[model samples]
Target: MFLERYHSIQDNKVLISARQGSLFAKEVAGDFNPIHNPDERRFCVPGDLLFALLVAHFGLSRKMTFHFRSLLGDSVPLTFREDDDGMIRVYDDRDKVYIEVEREGESTRDQSIIEHLIRSYVAESGKNFPHTLKPLMESQGVMFNPDRPMIMYQSMNLSLTTLDAPEPELELGQATLVPDGKRGNVTLDYRLMSRGKEAGLVSKKLVVSGLRDYDPNTMDAVVEQFYRLKEKAWD
Candidate 1:
């Protein structure tokens, strides 16, 4: 019953900017401060804010495939904890989220499990961190008849750094990323594929949008909005 699968931050590129606490937490504290903005009384949490920032920093992917320029340069170890229970487990001492790709032929579509685990992980995480699938679900919701998503078999480099590449004749959706990192040429497109049939259902260049802070208060509201779109975003 291989339905669908996903990959999070799987590289060793996560910058460890804090000891007792992560720098990400510190950033969240400032932005998600409840008292900071009286008009914007909502305020986010360190964990939730960190996740959103990762989405922004990493550049959203179509079926979970991130752009090359958005990740750590050269070689980075793709790592994450196994199973949904321990997947998004954000430890109080560590402000980080683990990422991983399932083993071959694995049924990655487990929305109930995903929702449950995320909910539990953030249950006591404060108003800022709403542990639910509302946000992600709003976009893609759930891949019910989840088909096999594209598997990136290989990625390479080319001459000319700063310059960009011509748009591919074939693609499922729009793909883009922050252009401030690398330089020289840009004739390369991070190619991708599906591990199963019906590969065209997904885009070769997936664009995963980062978490958005709202003018309205609370992460719960964001979660509710996520599920509405997640089911169709992939389509």
Candidate 2:
């Protein structure tokens, strides 16, 4: 699987190195969030990495929900456990849970379906910054620090009416960012369509910490620089 390079599995435990996580963010997800930079002092693993791994291991379900509890760093050993109820949990050495995945409906082991869903969902989710997020923050009158943007994935859930259709696609429906002091919670509602028909709805939550007052000029510069880096990467 394409996800093998992002993590290592040994003795039923998995670990994602900083370099691997950084590559997955930039190369796979096309996300350039500073928090995923390997050299950053507070670098954290991308939640999308965890999401990919979960599906790769257990296969894709018609309806799924993931709850993130804590951020995982490089060299942290994570163990996966699933109960009889079909709930999967990823925990660290101290028994601290990092992520929980609940799946319902039928699960498919078809690699093609799994990879297609992974690629499609990650691509849509990665467009958060500088695209969907910029307008959302503007409406809320708050934004993250331009120097050190700290946006983190909080949770995500999707309910699909049918997974039988092919060519699944995601489209942003609505979004809202609610600020609480220097922190804010972003709720993005999206719709999943298959062959031009709506098949499901998804809700993604993100937490932006270390926020500051929104400055139009500063935000404009940030958005410009973001695309510059993206362009430079592909060039």
Candidate 3:
């Protein structure tokens, strides 16, 4: 799932945060583990770290592997590793399901459910979306910029100018955001989305403007909100 990690372990400590996945982990399976919760012991250290690492490695292999209270009462331990060709392979303790990362250079013409959903969210959002076709949409640290959250927005195309407004507000270091896929050519949305549904769409308006004519106060508020709710799409 999104909360898995890939460790290049030598002794015990993580050699590097090689793969940091920050996405939603599913408990779709029957036997979801208690440790997956935020309050579980060392939850922050192990759970988040592991998930981030898995995402960095797995990309989008399975549907975030959710196993909540298996058909039988059993705890399923998560497993991860790389194959000879450097593919990510994962298995639940029960071994009922398995996910193997596609070869690195393969095209995503055939993507998983989650990958499809993510693509859908970006595609419907409007014109000039990334479609993420070129050099790959993902990267380290640069995936987000508090000042310009939409830089990585999987737009369908790119434009000389794109803008959004209504100046939504969010807590410091964050903001509420939604995918707004229905809104043609959107950089961001003021509304928040229901994470329960992986990909929600919205229709709204965006405007292009000059930096000098822009108000820092409004931008600051919207930027903060963007940071807070970005993960949810509307945050």
lDDT of 1 by residue, 1-235 (tens): 1111111233333322222122222222222222122232222223323333333333222233212222111112322233464222222224223332212212223344323322322222222212212232233332111111111112121111111122211122222222222211112232221222222222222222332322233434434543443333335
What does the lDDT read for residue 5 in candidate 1?
17
Alpha-carbon TM-score of each model against the true structure: 0.18, 0.94, 0.21
For 26-124, candidate 2 gives per-residue lDDT tens digits of 888888887787898899999999999998888888889999999899879998889677789998889999999988897788887788788889988
Q: Pick the candidate with the highest TM-score.
A: 2
In order of lDDT, best first, we have 2, 3, 1
Give the whole-model CA lDDT for all candidates, comma-separated. 0.25, 0.87, 0.29
Which candidate leads in lDDT? 2
- lDDT of candidate model 2 versus the reference: 0.87
Better of 1 and 3 by TM-score: 3
Span of 10 residues, lowest total lDDT, candidate 2: 158-167
Candidate 2 or 1, higher lDDT: 2
